[model samples]
Target: MFQPDIEIIAHTPNPEKVCTAAVKQTYKKMHAKELIKNTSEEEVEKLLTNIAKLGHFSTLEHACFTIAFKDVSVLFEQFLIEHRLASYSAKSRRYVDFSEAGFVIPDYFEDKPEMEEKYRKCMLYLFNSYKNLLELGIAKEDARFVLPYSFKSSIIATMNLRELIHFLYNSIYGHGKEFSEIRKVGGMLLNKMKKLCPTVLRYFDILEHKGNASILASTYESSKSEGVELLWHTPSPDKSIAIAALIKSTNLPTALLKDIKQEEMERIIQSVVRSRRPRELEQVNFTFRINNVTLAILTHITRHRIHSPLIPSLASIEKSSSYVIPKGIKENKEALKIYREAFDRCMEFYRYLKSKNVPKDILAYALQSGNFITIITTMNARELYHFFRLRTCLRAQKEVRNIANNMLYLVRNVAPLTFKNAGPSCYFYGYCTEGKMKCNRFKEVVEHYKAWHLSPTKIPGL
Candidate 1:
């Protein structure tokens, strides 16, 4: 229920102040003792403008600011934390429980009482069901299976001057998509900064450029306008293509196999073995030693479809490309032969592994080279907790489970607040998404996590 604004108790990296001081030093260095020189503050502001045009960003980082933040959403909080240079504190879920917490109602939800009523009913149902479940011996862990992501929380963001400037650029008036609740707060904070350090905060003094400057020769150009700005993008992939090419190897004959090098025999052996698994899912249990080239191919192919691979590397591609339909005028059949042999060898091994009394889980792990494929998914505390609850289950893919586990290590250190209580169904979510397979011990899991990990705390005003 409490929505707060920026309360700057302190700050550093005052760019305007530093630029003014730096520019004035130019005079003091020259005059030394001669001139009773205090450069007019107007001169300082003008000098700061030119300095910004020169793109000296580091000078700005010297200025710092500490802000108090209150009442932000979990998603928005994560967005702030992702900006590493900033620090945060938020309200605790455990010590100060949300049992009677007042949550934020989205604009549209509040605008329509009927819609709000339905929404409140749903959320209340979830909370009450969870509470009742807890009272009825179903753990809070199990009860929380119904909670919605709209649950609101708050945080306090403490950042340096450079960061504060950056936040201002992204979230102020006259900015695009200023609807982000945090950005509005940022605008208010910037106003306060301008007041405390009038000469220093001159860079964000935009009226000079955006308004009066339009009475111009080249239209707001010659004088060079300025202020803070932030830019971000979904960066393009940069992994080397050569890696993909390298993975194209060993789907053929000339390549010497690590454990077996013979050509014709390995081919015959792998083919007969691989042919047995008719369905892609059945391939899940197949034992095949995928070479690096094969693994890379499988990586690209499976990511494209989430399907089981055929030959799983360059070899499969070559074999199929060669016989099924050939479009290229110059065909290198030898590469095709090597691929055939490698896959054959794998099929033979899979056949042997299947016949023996080996376990499905063990056989699944035995894959190397072509054996394992990894998916790159990134999430912070809240998201990671959700993923672990759903994906670390007995029903989740064995390989995905491994990935989820590995990611949890990074998640814990980076955003301790959100992830401290994150992990498998028993910990993050109650029971199972697959009802029949559920352990139904979510309450015990939540209590266990609560005992060990600190609940998130919302820091005031950023």
Candidate 2:
């Protein structure tokens, strides 16, 4: 019976006027400050109306909205975070105790009393197992592996008008249309926008007819795998990076790069990457196929925006025995028994729901935090460097840190020179960034990476 509780916590004051002034500054000689002062209410409305009609929505980016969502399912949370242009802060299952957290009952169960009872029983068992694991001295982070996707979560998200419009459009007419929960949330968001910005909603009809074709459907065929695999990368990534660096640093013609030797390219790559701002590294890109990634750790990777990660839809979640057990839980016999039993019960419930032929979207609620998924992501060299710097640190979550280490190993093999010094901040900058939370194993960590830097061809143990 859970419903998403959404509220607009804050928004730009006089959003229409702000957008109008932003639009005017693009064409008029007056600065934005003067334009805002002189623009009348009627003028603002008329200008925004025209701007919407003209499909010039960049001006809309100036008006931002911050929203809070409560009692929403983790499924919806995943859907919302896919809009990478926005900023989001959600309740962390890792730190928060969810033993008593209520769950969402899909609308399909409203009339089926017996089915609803069964569903409730299953949810209670999962929550009870989670609590029992906590009592058995399991870390909250590990105990959360049994929590289903239906568990309610809270999130605060900020997005500008341009991205908001895109998000709404997708919710109504694109991939989000496949899920009832997403549609309900979308309707609520649209209602909020009507009250907050009536002028802009007047032109919403234009968006309705405009099809959102960004969602693609396809079937992937691949062997079952675990760990990160380098699928593809720019051809001759080292040369690509070196030439880009040369173009930025010198006025030399593009053809002159052909004369550069392998030794010279190495020197150029080392110098550019070691610089304070290595913008040239962006010229090279790498795509990785990461398998057996738990949903809990997936958030860690996706939170690093500025990359494209192709994740499976919630509806695609199926019954599987695949799940992750943290090292700590594995070491405790009592905790390990409870953990395995919890996953077994969840999967057994999933099969029962499958026999009922419930919609896959709702059935996805059976998925637990530790359920394994495969995803493909592409990142530019600059962003990869940033990703490694944060996720390869000793303080990072163990699962994600392992994936990051594997990725570093792969990328270093192909573009050794470009990523010569790529590693944790301490290794890259020669100092730790974690203040009081320092791992205090600086010498050991530095030496570990130093070996990889010196021997890029060797496969290091993850």
RMSD of each: 25.0, 2.0
Model-by-model lDDT, in order?
A: 0.40, 0.86
Count of residue pairs whose backbone atoms collide, per candidate:
48, 0
lDDT tens digits, residue span 15-58, model 1: 35554665555556655223224545676567666665665545
- Give lDDT for model 1: 0.40
Highest-TM-score candidate: 2
TM-score of 2: 0.95
Model 2 weakest 10-residue run by lDDT = 214-223
lDDT of 2 by residue, 159-229 (tens): 99989988988887777887889988988999989887787877776844566544566533332887899
Q: Model 1 segments beyond 4 Å from truth?
A: 12-19, 22-40, 92-96, 109-111, 129-146, 172-183, 197-404, 407-462
